[model samples]
Target: MNRLAILSVSDKTGLIDLARVLVESYQFQLISSGGTAKALKEANLPVTKVSDYTGAPEILGGRVKTLHPKIHGGILSRPDLESDRADLTANDIQPVTLVVVNLYPFEQTIAKAGVSLEQAIEQIDVGGPTMIRAAAKNHQYVSVLSNPAQYNAYLEELKAHNGETRIEFRRSLALAAFSHTQAYDRAIADYLTKEILNEAQAKIDLMEVSSTGATSSQPSLSSSYTLLCHSPKPLRYGENPHQPATWYQLGAAPKGWSAAQQLQGKELSYNNLLDLEAARSIVAEFWNDAPCAVIVKHNNPCGVAIAPTIAEAYQKAFAADSTSAFGGIVALNRPIDEETAKALTSTFLECVVAPACVASVATILAAKPNLRVLVLPEMQQGTSETVKLIAGGMLVQKSDDLPATPETWQVVTQKQPSPEQMQELIFAWKICRHVKSNAIAITGDRVTLGIGAGQMNRVGSAKIALEQAGDRTKGAVLASDGFFPFDDSVRTAAAAGITAIVQPGGSMRDGDSIKAADELGLVMVLTHVRHFLH
Candidate 1:
């Protein structure tokens, strides 16, 4: 008797090729449903439709095609058990040897803009998950493939074992099948929860049409939380060599850091990736303005600069804090050139990331064998929300990515800033947002002169920044993540010869700082927005 194989899939990638090989090489009968059946027949391959094989017409617009007893019995039957064999024979059911199936694109559908709840509900697969779970539970006598990427591996296994899959291979595929269904169900649950919350909020808004004035700018919290991560790649260690670590990607398809191509050097450690992300975020701030470079150490940016050329940008950023730049992660907004590659290789850096790198420059970078080089084209794509695990729960909030609008700023001092000084202030303000509070950053001539981050108090942070800048503070600008509580910091900045100051002014004693700035003949601007990164 010929072996039986059921092929049902939403993604058609490598479908015809796999089906043809199964029919010609393995002598397996094909049973498919809906689009899969039509595709196989169109290619002039032999296939039996599920409706025809079960001797039942598809009802409810083809949704009831694969939920029949024959389909489930064939997938769950065990040839070794006498009772199962008798039941299969009594019902004239053929035992299914292989199940090639994938679910509908539910996540992709909901990712689109303006998708309705009904539309997303329609995309959720019912019979697909049912059949997948059944096959996975009976992996001893069945082999299930849930993704297109598994087709080649399945074929290789069959070829190696003389047209029969090994028990271990089938077990692995079964595990993947269950994981696939779990992720699908989680996506559906998350979508429904969000839509239901929005519907309830809309009703509340209608009830209080005139009583409540305005809604809060903050996004509402969700009651339910779900995360689907897979493909755990083990690292040598975490932040330290003693801590064990593993990297789990978010989805079946690789994205974000997983999508980045590492051109050379050692595997990335946990700390290396953290520092690289900090550098990436800071360099992304100046992506379209000019060639920019940022160096990060211990999850904080130590140097950031923008120049007319990529080589000059790296040089300026490195010169900003040479001592801290050693063994730091570097990010560049432009492609790596020969000049930049030479400058990058001159230092003992942990990693260097850019949008692109040519073959010649890559060869030059090869001189540093242990330095990691990554090319990620989408450097500006950031997460929509950030999550942190806490005691017995987690915290979730929207990312602080609000744009810096200098035109709406209030000049609260007697001295006004020039166009050039205003641009410098905006640059400093952008970098300050990424630093840990209490944060202070001093910049001059489009380069960071000194940075004071994660201090106990604002005055202490200001003193550290000014002392580090030294003579550079004479013509530089200062940016604070929060409003000054007193005029002492303002006086301290003026004493350091700070030409202008930018801060989020909402403190109770804002007048004292404004008066101090006016008396000291310094330009002070209030952004009306606070960016306190903890």
Candidate 2:
């Protein structure tokens, strides 16, 4: 009695090789479906189509192929139980020892541009996941393989065990199969929710055709969320030395923080990753062919600047707050040239992350043994939901990837801002958006003079920012993450000699703040875009 092996897969990565080995080395009967059957037949291997084995033709566009009792009975039969043995004999079902299957490319299909809902629905492999789950659930008597990469080792194991697979290997393959199906279903669910939200947004746009410039797109609620967690690599230490940590990658393709490849330096610490993310997020805002640099300390932007050249940007960003730049994370929008690398190496920086680095420049940074150099092309543009863990459940939200413009703000003050003042205010607004709650950013000449973040009160943050600006506060502009609840902040800014201010004006006493600005001879702009980063 030859053991039966079911080979049904959408991905033909190692189908022929695995089929030939199972047939020749292991002496197993090949049972395949659809494309897998076609490929195996082309290889001149003796194969039985799943429909032929089940005596049921695939109907309803091949959706009804593997849902038959004959196909599942073989994989699910328990040879130990008398009832299970009788059922298998009554159905003339042979025990299926191996199931080589992989799900359809649902994620890749939907990721393509201009894909339709119907098209994506078709790509959702109904029978593939069904078979995978069935085999995985009955892993005691069945072996499941979902990835083609498992072929060589599985063949080796069978060859070693005299055409028999161990329970441990079978259980691991079952786990992999289950993970594959879960990820597939998750991709389909996420894509469907996205489509529904897009359609809903389209309807809203149709209803409010006049409301064009508002925040049109938001991540809508989905039924379920799934993350394919894998690739666990050990780290030196966690946030603290006593705590243990391991780095895990989510999904197959690398993006954002997961995409960073460290080139030169000591091993990355837990705090190092946090600062890197903050710097990357900030610099990504100015990644549009501009030379922008951001210096981050403890997950807050201490210095940020944009200049004609990357070296100049790094210089201006460093000059913004030299005290905080020491031992801080540096992120650049442009590649590090020789000049920029030399300038960066001059500082006592912790890490330098960019899209690319010249070989010689990487060598120049190599001179600093402790400086971590990371190259991440995905930093330029990528979309991912922000998920944070709480006490019992999780909080999911859309990332604040909204684009800002100087034109969107309303000039509310009697003393309207000058053209340069508006530009300065917009630049300040962009930085303030990323700062912690009760944040204040003071800027002049396209650079941050000072930032007061995570203060308990808006006035306290404003005072700190103004004081940090010091002499520069006389001509600098100010931006607040939220609207000032009281007029005292306005008075404080004006007293600091701040010329212009930008904030989201939604407070009940907006008139009082406006009156204070008017009385103090100050220019104020209301962005109506409150960015409270708590």
Candidate 3:
């Protein structure tokens, strides 16, 4: 009896070559299903369909094709066991020596625009995973090829060993097969979780219209959902020297932090990853044709600016606080052109991140071999949940993705901000949300003049930011991450020649703060929403 190779795949890359080699060189019988059978037959190879091999027609719209005893028994039989061998011979089922199977495109299905729940669920592969696991579990006498990329290497092994596979090679292939199945299941779970969350949101919307019922399984409140985040890449160190760290990307499809590919320099440290995400998140806020740059240090935005061109954006953002921009992480929204790359090299920056870089500019950045450069195309899009670990429990919350519009901004002060000033105020508020608590960012003409982050007191942050602004404070507007408790911050701003202030006006002493802004001739706007980053 000839050794058999089972081939069932969604991706048909290199399938014909693998099938021809198995038939002509290895003298192995070929069995396939659905599209794989059609593809192999088209190539003029003698391929057996799973349905025909099992002597049973497919049922339930091709879902129950390979779930029969003949298919599983052949792949799962133990050659060493007399009873298993007898069962296979008595059932007239030929032993399956090699299994080539790849899962359905569940990730690609859900990724389509406006994909429905039914469409997503239908793409989940049942028979493919089952066949893969059956072969992998019996790897002692079976070889499972779970991916098309494995075909060339498997063919090379047969060529080297004269149509025989080593035990070690089989074990490695089994491990790869297991990994593929696990990643496929994880994608399915993530899609289902998002579906549940979407339905829960719909329930909330219905409740807002008329309070009637509540959803039992709210994604935000439930802790039982299987949230999968695999693919761990070890890092050099954590935030400190003695601690260890690793980077684990969430989900199967690459996006956000997982999608960023480090092109050069040392491995990303924990602090580097933190600052990189902070810088990228700030840059993500400005999703438009205009170029924008954000500089982050200690996980806070020190400088940020948007301009007509990439170079000027980098120049203005760096000039915001040249002292802080030194050795800081830089993120750009647009592709890094030669001019921007040249401007960036003028400062001793720690890292430069962008969606894409021109070839000439990448060559320019390559000069500084130690500078960490990342090219992540997914930076242009993002929407995620915030997960936090707390004492004896976990805290899950919605990301602070609220937009600041005119309807949400109330002119609480007797002095309302001018149209131009209002735009600048909103811009400052957007940047402030990304800054750490006790944060104050002074802005002028839509560019940050100075930022004080992680200060012990609100007044301290205001003073530092004002001091950095100096002459620029004459026309600059101030944005606080939280509400002001006392009039001291207002008095400090007045003394520094600050023209306007934006804060969440929720403190009991809000009256005093409003009065101080009125007396100082400062335009104060209250955004009922509070953005507190601790």
Candidate 4:
């Protein structure tokens, strides 16, 4: 008996060709619905409308077309069992040996500029998924094809195997079809639930819903957002020996890093990704009209400097902590020129990331074959959620994107900051806010001289920052990431000839600190909000 094939598709890329082969060579009767039937009819192919075979007219604006018994019975029937054949005969249902279907343009509909929820809802294919699932359930006999990418290979296999596609191939295609439907349903359900129903709901809600409803039975916290993790590739190893790690991309739809063209280098490790993230963030802060150098060690900036020339910036940043930067990751805001590359090659560094690496510069770096070179086209965009794993759960917060403007700055001292001091104060404030707290950064000539981060006390951080600045502290401006709990921090900075100070003045001893600043003839400004990056 001739096999029955059903073809229903929203994307008719290679539909006509496939239909021609199925009809002429395989002698498979084509059953189609709506647009697919119309397309086949237009091409003058012998096609049976699904409603005709099902003995039911398309109803409810075509929604009730394929949900009838005849279509589903043929799709769900098991050809191996005699009882299944008897039931098919009793129901007057011809076994649907093959099903080729692709759903409506839900992805395309969502991608449209001003698509509404109603429009998106309408595009969700009920019949298409139902038919695909029915076919997949009988994968032992029925071959299901949902993607056009599988068309040519499937046709070749059918031609080679005397119109009988292999069970293995059919099973794989069935799996793909199910996955396609699952991802499709997920996109629609997620869009409606998150965007239309609750705009403020976390992105993880979709994943949680999918996990609960789908095959994956993983439990998820109601309050927590779901992190869509993808390991693009395996890494060399982790941070240290005896620890295994892999880099995971965060977003459900990744545009960069995970998709970036890795022109050269070995596999990236967990620490590599952490250092790269730090380098990318720091370089992004100074990308526009400024040459900046950022040396990152363990997801924290060891040194960062801005200058007229990339070489000078690298030199100043490296000089800040040569020991820490020995095997660190270096990022440049500007393009890597020959001079910059030469300076970079002089030192032994683990990785270098920039927007563009010059041909000559790339050739120079090629001397050190193991040095990982990455050309990031754009800086990493800031995320909306910040996640930190606690003992048993996770702590979540809205990312700190607090704007630092001159209007927001408050001058709390008897001696206000000079105009030059105000410029450096704002610059230092911006840099210090991004560093780990308790944080202190000393800046001069639009470049960071020293930074002290993640310390116990604010004064201890200030002293460490000043000590690193050394002679550079004389004319440098200092910024404390948070308030000075005591007047001693003010006295310490004053003795270092710090010139000016910027901090969040919430301390009860603010008057004493102001008095100390006045005695040293230091310029002091207070920003009401404290930025502690830890």
Candidate 5:
């Protein structure tokens, strides 16, 4: 009896070649179903239709074609066991040696612009995953291939071992098959979660308008969900040298940092990625504004500025705190030009990311061989949900990406800010939200003068930021992430020459701070929304 190979796939990328090799060179019998069988016959390769081999007609619109006992028994049988061999022989089933299968395009179907739920459900593969899992679970007796990219390697393995695959090679292929099914299941679960939640919200909106009963409570988060990550790339180390680290991409398709184009420099470390995300978030806040630049150190924005020219923005941001800017991560809203590239090379930095760069900018940046440069055009796009890991389980929440509405803010002081001061306050508030609490940021002329973050007390943070600004605090504005519980910070800001202040005003003693601002002739604006990043 000839060894049998089953070929069933939704993506027929390398199917013809693999089938031909198996039939002509290895003398293995081929069995296929539906479109795969049609494709093999069209390619002039000999194959046995799965229905013909199993002696059962395909039922339920081809959904029950491969769920027969003959197909699964052949795949799960043990050749060394007497009972298994007897069952196979009694049923006249050929023991399957190779199984090649790939799942349907469920992810692609849902990614369509206006795909309906029924359309997505129809694309979900049932028999395919079943066949794959069975083959993977019986890896000791069979070899399974779940991806088109594995075909060439499978051929190489067969050739290396004299027309047979080694046990270890089969084990690795089984692992790949299991991972493929797992990722497919996760995608389906996530899509259903979103769809079900949106549907529930729509019904609630309908009820609120029609019914006279008490209002319904908001829908809570899903009780459980799965997260799948693939393509693990090893890194040098994590935050410290002793800790090992690896980068795992979230999905099969790359986006965000995984899709970044690295123009030059060495690989990014764990800390570099963290700082880069912080820098990206800060720069994203000013994407619609003028040319903007942000410099981050230890995952906190040390400098952020917007200027008429990209080079000027970078220069002013660097001038915000030159000492801390050293070896910091940089993110820019505009493309890098000649002047900006020249200024960038003058300093030793860890990384620089931008929307794009001129053709000549690469050569200019070549001076710093160790600087990791990246280009991500869609810098404004971010994850809708943020996930954090705690002791045993993880926490999930909506990302704090609300827009800044300075127009809705109220003037809580006797002195009102000028138009220029209002713009400065808006800029300061946008940057303040990204800083770690207790956070305080001072800005002048649309550039960060000084930022104090992660302090124990609000007053300590204000003092650090004011002292960093020094003389620049004259005519500058200050923005705080939270409300001030006391008037000491307000008095201190006025004494440091801060002309305007912006903060969320929900504190019990807010009147004390307002009275101090009025007495000192300083402008105070209350936004009514507090942003605390810990």
Candidate 6:
């Protein structure tokens, strides 16, 4: 008896070629359905229509074509068993040796322009997956071809090995086919449950979306969504040798940090990711047109500076808190050059992230194998939502979307700031927005002179900020992340020769801070909204 081969496909990429080989070279009887039969007939290939073979007309819009036993009995019959062969002979069913099939384009139909939900629902293949699975399950007796890419190799194997494909090759193709169908069904079910159904049901549907998409041409339902939480790996030890602890990447994807591509260095540790997050958040606050460098330590900004040259910004920021810069994470808005990398490697730093790294500079940094390097293709700027975990739930809030427009700002105090002072004040205000609550930023000549963050009271934060600035406070502009609870901070800043002040004015003692600024000959502007980074 001649070998039996079935061909059914929605995507007819290499169908004609496969059909020709099956009829002319292999002498296999080609059985096809609907469009497959029509296409094979046009090519003058010998083919049998599926409905004609089954002796039943296709019903229900061709959906009921291949669900009959005459087709599946041939595929499912055990060729090794005399009983199976007897049953197949009694039913006049020819045993199918090879099954070539691909499912309808459900994904493609759904992705099309102006495709209705009903139209997309119709594209879901039923009998196709059933046939594919039946053949795949009996891979020992059947050869399954789901992808057109596999056709040539399969034909070669059969031609070389007396028309029998290898068992291993058959098994691999079956596995891929099952996985493809599973992903497809999951996507369809998830889309229907979410988009077509109501909100309460939609939340439940959200959990069903798969992370991976099917790439294989065969229909297999093996790839499904699975939820697994991963534990973090601690480096060397914890905070101390006696401490037992590990860290994990937050299950939530890191916002803009995800765009960064690591160019060179060792795998990033928990501490490295934390510091990078802080630095990236701070640097992203500044416009991409501006050159900025942020040095982060223990999830806090030690120094941040904006300048015309990235090297100059890095130098100024490093000068701000040289003591805290040890093993710090550095982030830049621009690319890193050989000169900048050399300057950075001079100090012990954990990592550096930029848009691009020059090849020569990357080679230079390769000497330090422990240093982590990252390249961010795009910088995320502007206001985004912030989510914080509380005791049992999350607290979602709008980020500090500070108005960069000058019109929103009010010069409430008597002393008007000079042009240079105004520029530094605006820059300091932007940097301060990313710092922790009860924060104070002191800057001079576009460089952060000092930052006092996470303090208890406004006055204490101001005092710390002044102390950090030391002599640099002279001719520096001061910015408070939040409103001044008392006028003491304004007096302290004025006493330090702080040229101007920028802060949100919502406190009951705002009048006192304004009065103090007027008396001490200081330029104080109220932004009307507080920015508490914590």
TM-score, every prediction: 0.83, 0.88, 0.83, 0.74, 0.93, 0.61
Task: Please write out the lDDT profile of model 1 over residues 432-479, one tens digit for every residue.
Answer: 999999999999999999999999999999998888888999989999
lDDT tens per residue, model 3, 1-534? 788788889989999998898899878898888889999998899988888898999889988888989889999998899999899889998888999888898887887899989988889999999999999999999999987878889998988898899999999999998988888887777678777888888887887677666544455534453445667888887988798888887765677878777877777788888898888778888866478889888898878888989789889989988888899999998888988888887778888899988877767887777888899887756556777777976777778887777577889888888899998898899899898888899999778988888899998888888888889988889999899999998988988888899999899999999999999899999998888898
lDDT of 2 by residue, 411-463 (tens): 88889777888878878888898899889999998889989999999988998
Worst 10 residues of 2 by lDDT: 211-220
lDDT of 4 by residue, 117-170 (tens): 888888989999999999998899899989887889889999899878888999
The candidate that achieves the highest lDDT relative to the unseen native structure: 5
Report lDDT (CA) for all predictions. 0.91, 0.86, 0.86, 0.82, 0.93, 0.81
lDDT of 6 by residue, 171-225 (tens): 9888977865666677677556545445544544554564554232223333333
Which numbered prediction scores highest in TM-score against the true structure? 5
Root mean square deviation (Cα) for candidate 1: 4.3
Cand. 2 Cα-lDDT: 0.86
Give Cα distance to truth, residue 37, candidate 1, Å: 5.1
Error of 2 at 109 (Å): 1.3
Task: Score residue 14 of candidate 4 by CA lDDT.
Answer: 96
Candidate 3 local distance difference test against the native? 0.86
**Candidate 2 at residue 163, lDDT?**
80
Candidate 3 TM-score over all chains jointly: 0.83
Better structure of 1 and 3 per lDDT? 1
* Candidate 6 deviant stretches above 4 angstroms: 1-256, 381-383, 401-403
Give stretches of model 4 more than 4 Å off: 1-71, 74-87, 94-125, 128-186, 189-224, 228-231, 240-253, 389-395
